[model samples]
Target: MDQSMASDLIGDLISCGNIDHAMVDGNKRPFICLELEDVSGNKLRNITLWSDYAQQLNDALGDRQNLGHVVIILQFMKHKIYKRKPAVSSMFGVTKLFINADIPDTHTFTKLLIENRGSEGDDHHVTHLTTFSSYSIKNDFLNNLQKVTINDIRDIVKPMSCVVVATVKKIEREADWWYLACVKCNHAAKQESVSEKDEYGVVVKKRSIFRCTNK
Candidate 1:
């Protein structure tokens, strides 16, 4: 409610999703979502950057390969419910963000990272996995690997060969939704349903389903 009452969160960037477009107030706007981890206490928080903040952060870090390694000091942050989930967000006109600074909290974070992970030269920036799909596919082979939080994987580059720990926020899925396969190859059969019986035993026809053209 007030600046003095807001909380200050210091952590390292763990996962940074792609900048996405959203319709806000009848206009298109940019927004970026990120996950941060507090190294001192091993806490995780979801962050949402909207409007100007989103644009600015994207422009600054978009080209950077190490999005996960950046240290973040969020001042005057407030906890609120967003996107049907709880998150900590920047307080407009009140919150200030510090990036990779030598502040006390940041120092503690760096020290912990170096001690636990050991410095790897200048490539110590956070390794960002752009999509969870990619991460899951690439990391499926790892067994008995140490679980590190998103913040802890700052040095993990793409095609993640090493296992890092992170909290799973939401697992998106659909019931009975799958790729249609080719009837001949049996490789995810695709079919164009000409007609189907409805619950009332009436025939109904719909648009063609997506199917492999080669089949």
Candidate 2:
């Protein structure tokens, strides 16, 4: 929680699914899956809105589909991996979303979007502005945490706590290793072979079976 500089995400909303319910922390909440494309870089990424923000965005959008006309600005955003996809989303009690604001970048983005839309023009530009007032910055405090290094993880003995700041330089592909898990208890499934008979009643071959003890 020592992070201070908030990550900023600016992109054009490409496609968004309908508001769906999900179980988060054992509580059912609302969310919407969104796909965004970076205008200048032309990169596609996924973004998900959860809880009240999901409802607010869905309500703001109404029946609009081409949200591409609007530029999305997520302030104080957090990075997460949802369903094995990289995502940028609002932080609870800290982040805020700004859509179609009067910012300079937004103006340029809207112009670009309009040009891309060609003669079709913009018929789905909802004039309704989206806003929320409960937003606040959490990193307003002075940073006093001691910074450490990856090498320090071993050098520093136990009972000592510090923060480590490092940039991910590379992500190497690793070998796939997935242990078979039980269906009922989710424990590792035991591997064994058992002989089975075919329709002819003769010993056909050996087969594998996954057994769940809890069931």
Residue 156 of model 1: what lDDT? 61
Per-residue lDDT of model 2, residues 83-179, tens digit only: 5666666667787877768899887766776676553335543233221211112232224445556876777655555555579897767965677
Weakest 10 consecutive residues of candidate 2 by summed lDDT: 129-138
> Candidate 2: where are CA atoms >4 Å away?
1-6, 65-68, 112-215
Between which residue pairs do clashes occur in model 2?
Answer: none
Query: Model 1: per-residue lDDT, tens digit, 52-144?
Result: 666666676767774446777777777776546667766667777777777788887788876766663256454453532334644655653
